[model samples]
Target: MTIDRCHQVLTAIDKINQQDPNKININGEMIAKELIYGHQMTACLNKYWPTANEYLQIAVRAQHVKRWHIARSTYPEGKQGYLTWRKDLGKMHAELAKDVMLDCQYNNEEAEKTASIIRKEKLKRNQDSQILEDVACLVFLQHYFEPFAVKHNDEKVISILQKTWKKMSAQGHEIALSLQLPEHLAALVSKALS
Candidate 1:
C-alpha cells in the first residue's frame, strides 16, 4: 500500500525478470496485507467471532507462503511429492490459525477445533480446486502482464510470476472476479441496493 513498498515489490520483481523466481518471499507479505486491508478482511473474517482478524491474518500469510513454495519449489514433480506438499501446506496453515486463535484469547480446545476446520477446508481445496487455482493464477498472470512471456529459463519463471502478480493489481480487484477464479469468485461482486 505504501509507495515505498510498492516500489520495493516491483524492484524485487524486476530482478527475476528472466524466469520463475521464488516470489513468495518478496510478495507474500504485501499481498497478505493487501488481502487483509482491501477485502476488509477484518469485517469478513470477524463474522465467526470477536477478534477474528488475527485468525484471517495468519491464514492469509500462510496461504501466500504455501503457494509461493508450491509454485517456486524445485522438487521432482510427482503425485506423491505434490500430495505431501499439499498436506504439509494444510498442516502448517492450520497450526498458524491455531496460534492466532489462541493469541486472541480463545481457549486451547476452541482454537484447536477451529484450526481443524481450517485444515479440512485447506485440504478440500487441494482436492476440489488446486489445479484450477494453479491454472487460474497462471492464466491471469499471463493475460494481464504476460510475465512468463519474459522467456524464463525455468530459474526465473517463478520470479516472473511473482513480480507480475504484484505489479498487475494492488486494489484493482476487477480482474480477479473475471479472471481465473471460479464462478464463485464472482459472487463477491457487490449488488447495490436497487
Candidate 2:
C-alpha cells in the first residue's frame, strides 16, 4: 500500500511536469525538458543509491517540477540575480512538492522530508541531501555542461566545474570520471580538477 501510494504521487508529479509549454529537442522528438529531466533524476538516484527510500526517490523526481513556470528573466541580471533565482527556485520546488505530497495523502513527516530534500537543507551535513546534490551535479555534467561550456569563457567554465566537483561526493566523482565526455570537455574537466 505504501509503495502504491508513492507511485501515485510520482505519477501526479510527472503529470504536472508534462503540462510545461517549453520544450526541448531530444532524439529528433520535441518533448518537455522538465519531464525528461525528472526521469533523469530518478535514473541517477537509482544508479547512485539503489537502496534509496521512497521519500528520496520522490524528492529526486520532483526536484524541478514545473521549473519553467518561474522564468529566469523575472529576476534581475548578474551573479546576484542568478543566486537569488536559484534560492527562490529551491523554495518554490519544495512548496510545490509539499502540496503534491499532501494531495497524495502523505503524512506531515513524509512531506517535510521531501520538502527538505527539494530545498537541499543541510546539503553537506545531511547524507540524503548530499546524495541528491551528487545526482543533480552528475545530471548537469552529463547533459547541460557541454552547452553551458560553449556559452562561457574557458576560465568561467573551469570555475563552474570546480564548484560542481566540490558539491559531489567521492562516489559521484568516481561516476563522473567514468562518463565518456567529449574529448575537449574531458580535457577541460581534467584541467579544472588539476
Candidate 3:
C-alpha cells in the first residue's frame, strides 16, 4: 500500500539520522540533532499543510537526512564555499532519500519525484518544493533562531535573517511572525524586517 511504503521510507530515513553523533539539548534532554530536525520538519508540515501529499511529506522529513556526514569545514571558506557546501549537501540528501524510497519499493518515478523535492528543484516554481522550504524556514524560526542569534552579532544575525526571509513564501512569513520567540530574538526579527 502507498501509506505503508511511505511509513517504511520515513522509518528508514529516521534510522539513518539516528546515527548522528551531534546532540542538542531539548527540554533538558539531549537528542540527536538531525533526528529532531526531521521530526520538526514533519511537525511544521502537518501543522501548516495537513493535506500535503506523501512525496512532500517524505521530502520534508528527509531534508537534512544524515546532514552531519558533510562537515562544513570540509569546504573552502567564504560565501562561495558556503554555497557550494549547501548545494552538495542538497544533492547528498536527495540521493540518500531517493535510495531509501527505492529500497521501500517506490517506483523510479515516485522515487525521483521525492528526490527532486529534497533537492528543492525549481523552488519558487514548484509548489511542493516551496512548501518544503516554508516548513524549513518555520522550523528555523521556531526552534533554532534564538540560539543562533545568541552566537552572532546583531548585524550579522539581521543579514542572515534577511537571507532566510527571502527564501520563504508569504505564508511562511505569516507563520514566522506568529511564533512566540524570546523577546530579544523577536526584536532582532523586527529589526531585520524593518
Clashes of each: 8, 0, 0
Task: Put down candidate 2 lDDT per residue, 1-194, tens digits, no spaces.
Answer: 88988998899989999998888898999898899999999998988799999988988999999899889999999999999999899898888988898988999889999899989999888888988999999999888999999999999999999999999888889999999999999999999999
* Worst-scoring 10-residue span by lDDT in model 3: 141-150
lDDT of 3: 0.94
Output the worst ten-in-a-row residue range by lDDT, candidate 2. 123-132
Best by TM-score: 3
**Per-residue alpha-carbon lDDT of model 3 for 48-128, expressed as tens digits?**
999999999999999999999999999999999999999999999999999999999998999899989989999999999
List the global CA lDDT of all models: 0.39, 0.91, 0.94
| TM-score, per-candidate, Cα-based | 0.36, 0.96, 0.97
Task: List, residue by residue over 38-105, the lDDT tens digit for candidate 1.
Answer: 22322323332234333333333233222343442655577777767777766765665566555445
Model 3 RMSD to the real structure? 1.0
- Tell me each candidate's RMSD, in Å, in order: 13.2, 1.0, 1.0
Candidate 2 error regions (>4 Å) = none
Q: In model 1, where is the ten-residue run with the lowest total lDDT? A: 185-194
